[model samples]
Target chain A: MEYIKEPMEIEERSFKIITEELGDKVFEEREGKIIKRIIHTTADFEFADITVIHSDAVEAALEALNGGCRIYTDTKMALSGINKKKLTQLNCQVYCLVDDEEVAKEAKDRGITRSIVAMEKALTDKETKIFVIANAPTALFTLCQQMKVGEVKPYLVVGVPVGFVGASESKEVLLKQNVPYITVKGRKGGSTVGAAIINALMYMIE
Target chain B: MEYIKEPMEIEERSFKIITEELGDKVFEEREGKIIKRIIHTTADFEFADITVIHSDAVEAALEALNGGCRIYTDTKMALSGINKKKLTQLNCQVYCLVDDEEVAKEAKDRGITRSIVAMEKALTDKETKIFVIANAPTALFTLCQQMKVGEVKPYLVVGVPVGFVGASESKEVLLKQNVPYITVKGRKGGSTVGAAIINALMYMIE
Candidate 1:
């Protein structure tokens, strides 16, 4: 009693391997752009990047924002992340949520960034595509689920949860999502690279 | 009797205008990457760009070459296009058809650049995804039909042919073909820009 589906399964697996290998092979010849590898832990971290790729992604993100994707993030973090307050200065509407309770309130009071008491509420009803790069897989998992069901669509997910174990687990979590995505393909992602990917994605997705 | 599609036609006609205006409104804010533009008309075309955008297109061409897309051009313009001897130095593979008479011999020669016969052969291969750019719609039309029936796949036609008057028409030919493609919208497209769009698409697709 041989199973007829085995051949189909084998063929499908072969196709996937071909596609993956074919795609990876092209990257070898790809020049001009740079990809930096990073390794870090929960103990200490510092740095930033704001480059985007696939230029269209940046255009799409800006369109989404104009169409009602509200900005939601910590003011200091966002500013520190990009090294500028001009992002907040951009007239487009945004909902900021500073991680610091006091700064969050002040931002909300001053209308500098949209402030929210809960992470869930802050990330909800936004028009911009969400980009998450967490240091913990659990954090990324929670954030991904929130964005998956939230108003914002994800253009790309950077599964670079830093620290010793989180990076690998983060990749696993993203792979489980079963969507068309691009990643660094290893456990070399950290806060800087994750932010760099977002910056690049934002640039590309805009 | 009312035509059901008239409203859609009118709306689409208006949509282009609205979209153009809106794009202008945000264009300053976006400040997208601008590849150098070139308007070539056989003669008086001086210099070529070797930017990252151009790199992408060349890489794609290289891949096609690796997978059997033959290189071709008018034999009369061969020695002037690029240092042919230098190209040969790169040492992958080469084919040529010197002028109209020796074209057959040149194709048989396999290492020279001057080619009139290979141009005819390349133009006639319908299976070839002839990625072209310029203002000549007629050239593309003739090339399309000449390239054997059922050989030229529909979507393989990337109508980035861009230039003065005929560019829009060339694009329309591709549009009529109803193929998946990528092209710069509005007035930003020229010969270089057209080529750049192909490069950008190759980056995204491959």
Candidate 2:
């Protein structure tokens, strides 16, 4: 398989292998696109079981993409993982406000994380369609808290923060929120997972 | 645990938890730092078992880093994951040439990956001390092939490409090469792992 394939065939071949290995895994087809992608990105089968996608997430995300909405991420690493060319084609923009001067000042003044402030800042942009949380669980938790107050109506939330701290627990909160969200159940996610989810959704829309 | 801890304490607490959970895992303290960082980034224990580190790789990498060397990566995502502030304090520079116009043109003409061309281009950088490969097996294979002919001698190579194709097979070749290297033994690696390894090494030295 390695010798005969061209360089471009690698990604295609990886998806094929993921599908074969994920045989008997029962995610709905709509959800499978994302599950397969997260699995493809990490080469970990754990996603197949742990991933949870809201019934409306896929359709909502695609619709939001078609509308050329704003996307926000917790980290620049996650921001970079998103394909820029494809995003531009869709007229979508990605922002990471954790490094913003105002956010830093406000977060520090309030004795809160920049992640928490960043999530709050995202709500100020009414064009935001998606929130991709990767490195900071506080970002995910803040979004959930805001959602509980009916403050922001995100088209989709990709909450895949990675760490031993509040990562998994934050994801559990995201799962229970009444919003379109995609998350993994346990302590198994990161910038890679968060970006893969966004890229996967983009591929689906494309 | 989450409620009482301050934002600054999150990272420290996460590392402590990783150490506790990783109890009984046998790795020399030096090697353990890299392994644990990979695990921390992905929240997966697979790396602890699959990581391979050359005996002198860490020392050589640190020495190179202290001299303010150049680092190259296969993908920009991996490049972004590297901590810029830490890297700057050491006077280390990171480059990802996959998007270089000359590389793109040559790769298209030769029907090879930009990754292959990118690795070859790194040799032109006389100060290049380390190569971090996360997205492309071709980059790893190219480096190993270059090493065989004594064309370029890298201080350290972090090979953690992902996928189902030649990703693992390329690492197998890298393992056989007489180079100072660190790699995961299978398909379970990505940009997150590569960057985490570099960041962990930076933290270790810091």
Among these predictions, the greatest lDDT belongs to 2
C-alpha positional error of residue A88 in candidate 1 after TM-score superposition, expressed in Å? 6.4
Report DockQ per prediction, comma-separated. 0.01, 0.62
Candidate 1 regions off by >4 Å?
A1-79, A83-98, A102-118, A147-152, A178-182, A201-206, B1-206
TM-score of chain A of each: 0.47, 0.93
B21-91: candidate 2 lDDT, tens digit per residue? 88888688888888888888888887888999999899999998888889999998899999888999999
Count of clashing residue pairs in every prediction: 22, 0
* Candidate No. with top DockQ: 2
Question: What 10-residue stretch in candidate 2 chain B is worst by lDDT?
Answer: B1-10
| TM-score (second chain) of model 2 | 0.94
Docking class of 2: medium
